[model samples]
Target: MNSNHPPTPRTLPTAAAADVPTFGCVVYISTLPDGRKKGRVANLDGIEHTAGTEREVLQRIVPVFKKRVSECLAAGDSVPWIDPILEIDPQEQKRFLPVHL
Candidate 1:
């Protein structure tokens, strides 16, 4: 979903600034506007920014993208980023693929 551009770090959900993960840089998430339950997927690097209408694709992944980041931090990983869920623009939210290197 994302493009060949750098991620603009805007204000986080709470903190003024946080650290983005190491290898878990990019992320792709989706939502089930129809409200149908489904499975989801994320790379080992914790990058999930896209989804399909499959059992594993799981569309309602948007509301939890930040949670996923939190989980990685809970696992004792150095997540050098913050949850910027509040600043996610609906139009810009679609570009979540092709993470930045």
Candidate 2:
């Protein structure tokens, strides 16, 4: 992770459906100094999952992200989307995932 350069975004695989509403989600995974991996979703505040590995963190966060999106939709609140590029930290790795709810 070079602090001088932005991390390249990687797209995660997803199953598609023409009728399902899909939203673009940016997930940032970073390694802490203490060796823990932390995952966070862009535009979503105070929601983070930390684990011993990247896969574990991601697995833990995705369901929560989906649930939040579902809740917002059911409540008639607009789900916020932010450009992941603008939120990028050079030290963190990013994943672009299509979230279907």
Candidate 3:
């Protein structure tokens, strides 16, 4: 085979992929009518939580996301979402998908 081209990247099994801990969920923030910022953190399983302020929402939702994941696992529910993290594997690209600032 010719060596001019780069090698094809290999795919790792979902389990085998190296996980790098990072923000796992997408938090949607908006200015409320009263000017307070509101946020909704959502995961792949359709689990979501709402809170006021970016700091507070993240603090609250991350734990809740973990709890939800645990519950989903305990019940033998297929984890619908990737574990919350930045996922450092070169195979994985980009943290959370685009979210409006």
Q: Score every model by TM-score.
A: 0.24, 0.70, 0.47
Best candidate according to lDDT: 2
The candidate 1 region of ten consecutive residues with least summed lDDT is 92-101
The total number of steric clashes, by the backbone 3 Å criterion, in model 1 comes to 12
- Model 2: how far residue 45 lies from native, Å: 2.2
Q: Give the Cα RMSD of candidate 1.
A: 17.3
lDDT of candidate 1 over 1-96, digit per residue (tens): 479887987975875555554333233334557643233233333334344443344334443555655676689886545455324334222233
Candidate ranking (TM-score, best to worst): 2, 3, 1
As for lDDT, the candidate ahead, 1 or 2, is 2
After aligning candidate 2 to the native by TM-score, how far in Å is the CA of 41 from where it should be? 1.1
Give the range where candidate 3 is weakest over 10 consecutive residues by summed lDDT: 92-101
| Per-residue lDDT of candidate 3, residues 1-101 (tens digit) | 56998889898776755643343466555556765555554445444434566566556656766666666667989657645622243322222433211
* Model 2 score (lDDT): 0.80
> After aligning candidate 1 to the native by TM-score, how far in Å is the CA of 33 from where it should be?
17
What's the candidate order when arranged by decreasing lDDT?
2, 3, 1
Question: Which window of ten consecutive residues has the lowest lDDT sum in model 2?
Answer: 79-88
lDDT of 2 by residue, 7-93 (tens): 999998696647887876678889999999998887676568899998998788878888888898999998665544347688889
